[model samples]
Target: MTAISVQNMNVWFGTGALRADAVLDVSFDVNEGEIFGLVGESGSGKSTILRAMVGLVPTWSGTMQIAGETLGKKRSQAFFGNVQMVFQDPYASLHPRHTVDRVLSEVMRLHGIADVDERIVQLLDDVGLGAGFRFRYPHQLSGGQRQRVAIARALAPKPTILLLDEPTSALDVSVQAEILNLLADLQQSQGLTYIMVSHDLGVVGHLCKRIAVMKDGEFVEVLSVEAMRRLEASHAYTKHLLASSIQSVS
Candidate 1:
């Protein structure tokens, strides 16, 4: 089943004389329970695609069909109920004053989910935080712990689709793998669909079978991770990126 279908999508900022395209003529399809990756350099418009899907960037044109429903300028409440985003900065995503419990509880309440108390505990556990971290404020948690809490909040609504925008980029190198493993586990246990955006080719390659490479607000190539690792790319930019990734780790 196709979970997301996008075609001829164009995202821009401003209008008329000042109009600038951030994403242009992009298209793709993601299967249900698949983990799709979008990778590119900064300013390549990778994050804008996720933002458009979640309705944060509303100035987009063209087609966006998610979970079989066509999207318009405004998203329905039901749309949000099925999709949630985990931002790149875990520290900034959570409220400084809110405890983990409140963060999760509020999301559930807004989604009209019942048994909030029970669900909070389960969500914490699902994200590998357990119940002890539930009452700690965002300031008190470590970066990895904070991200887990953020993931818990997103999961509170039982969303089937998760938009991950460099979810592990802001964390310590040692902590990155732990969070990645946790996400993999959750996806397996719950059958979740993921759309992850990252500049790190290796990160995306590890988590996603296929990836779209972008340059200057357009998809230059779409290929499997196997092709990415083998440095086999039809586009020159993708070849450069693959070589850079190889050199970075060398």
Candidate 2:
């Protein structure tokens, strides 16, 4: 089953002479309960594709489907319930003034979910944070803890599909592994599907079974993890990326 399907999607910014395409004729399908990765350098239109899917970038053309339902330029409340996004920066994504309890509770309130208190505790526990962290502010928590809170908040709405944009780039290497492991566990336990965007090939390689390499607003190649490990990329750009990733690790 296809969890996400995008077809001929084009996203443009500015107007008239100032206009430029951010994503061009991009299309892909992510299977249910699978982790699909989009990898590229800065300004490669990877994040733009995610933003467009959630209707953050409004000037887009073509069709997008979530769980076989066509997505519109403006997503409905029901759409948000099924799909949620976790940003690169946890500190910026979360509300500084709201305590962890309030943060999780607010999402449940919006979705009309009952048993808010129990759900909040469960969400915190699910993300590896105990109930003691509930009443604390963002400033009181470390980067990894804050990110765990962010993950808990994203899960609060019981979303089936998660869009992760550089989810661990801001964390330390050890913390990144923890978060990635947590994500993998969550996906397995909840049967969730993920579309993760990152520039770090190592991180993508760890989490994704298949990856799409993007460059200059288009997909250069879509390859399986096995092919990537074998250095069997067909595109020059993909080979370059793989070389860079190898160099970075070595």
Candidate 3:
């Protein structure tokens, strides 16, 4: 089953005189329970695709479908309930003033879920934060802990699809591994689909079965993770990226 389908997607910014294309002629499908990766350097429109899907970037033209239903220009509340995003920066994404408990509780309230207290604790536990971090502020936790809270918050609404934008880029090397493992576990346990955007080919190679390489607001190539691992990319741009990734790890 296709969890997400996007065709001929274009995202533009600015008006007539100052207009710019952020993403152009992009298309792809992510299967249910699959981890689909978008990889490229900054400003390559990897994150723009994600922002467009969630309606954050409204200046877009294309057809987008989530779980076989056509997505309209204006998303309904139910649409948001099925899809959620976990941002790159945990500290920036979370509300500094709101405690962890309040952060998770608010989502449950918005989703009309009863027994907020129990659900909040369960959400925290699900993300590996446990109940101990409930009353803590974002300042009190480490980067990894804060990200776990962010993950918990995104899952509070019981979303089936998660859009992860550089989810571990801000964390420590050791912490990055933990967060990645947590994401993998969550997807397996919850049967969730993920659309992850990152510049790190190593990270994507580990998490995704398939990946799309984006360049200058368009996809340079779409290939399996095995092709990426074996450095067998056909496109010149993709081969360049693979070479760079190999050099970075060496």
Candidate 4:
């Protein structure tokens, strides 16, 4: 099953003289139960593509399909239910005033899902968060803990496709490893289709089966993990990015 198909996708912000293109003719496919990695440097339009997929950037012109339903045209509740996103900043994603329970329960209520206490608890557990922390506020949790809450919130909706925007970029190296492991475990158990955007090639290599490298709002290279490990010749931009990312990781 194909989870997402983006064709001739073009994104530009503003209008007339103020217009600036964020993504230009970008295209990709994410298969069901597979992790498709999107990698690029800063200002590479990675997040812009995600924003377009979720209908946040509706001004863009392209063809995007999520689970056989065309985006932008389909406003069905089922469409929203099948897709969910975990943003880059856990601190910003969650409301400081809302408890973990409230955050998860609100989504449940919106989806007309009743008796979510048990389900929420299970989701929290699945994300490695204990029941004792269920009622705690965001400020009470550590960076990793808060990210876990964000992941739990995303999973609480029971989405088939998860769009992750550098999910572990803010954490320490050790914490990043833990979160990466947790994400891998969750993907395996749930059979999820993941579209992860990150600048970290190591993270992409570890978690994703295939990776698409973006440059100037377009994908310049798509390579398998093995091909990347071999360090074969690719586009100049991809080569530069790989070298820089490797240096950063070292």
lDDT tens readout by residue for model 2, 1-250:
9989999999999999999999999999999999999999999999999999888899999999986679875677878888899999987998999999999999999998999999988898899999999999999999999999999998998999999999999999999999999999999999999999999999999999999999999999999999999999999999999999999899
lDDT of 4 by residue, 1-250 (tens): 7888999999999999999999999888888999999999889899999888887877888888898898775467877778889999988999999999999999988877777989988988999987989999999999999999999888877899999999999999899999999999999999999999998999999999899999888899999888888877379987887788778877
For residues 1-250, what per-residue lDDT tens digits would candidate 3 score against the true structure?
9999999999999999899999999999999999999999999999999999988998999999996668887777878889999999987999999999988898888988898998888888888888999999999999999999999989988899999999999999999999999999999999999999999999999999999999999999999998887888999999998898899999
**Comparison by TM-score, 2 against 4, better one:** 2
Q: Judged by lDDT relative to the true structure, which candidate is superior, 2 or 3?
A: 2
Report lDDT (CA) for all predictions. Answer: 0.93, 0.94, 0.93, 0.89
lDDT of 1 by residue, 120-166 (tens): 88888888889999899999999999999988888888889999999
Off by over 4 Å in 4: none
Model 2: colliding residue pairs: none
Superior candidate under lDDT, 2 versus 4? 2
TM per candidate? 0.98, 0.98, 0.98, 0.97
Tell me the lDDT of candidate 1. Answer: 0.93
Give the Cα RMSD of candidate 2. 0.8
The true-versus-predicted C-alpha distance at residue 110 of model 2, in Å, is: 0.8
| Candidate that scores best on lDDT | 2
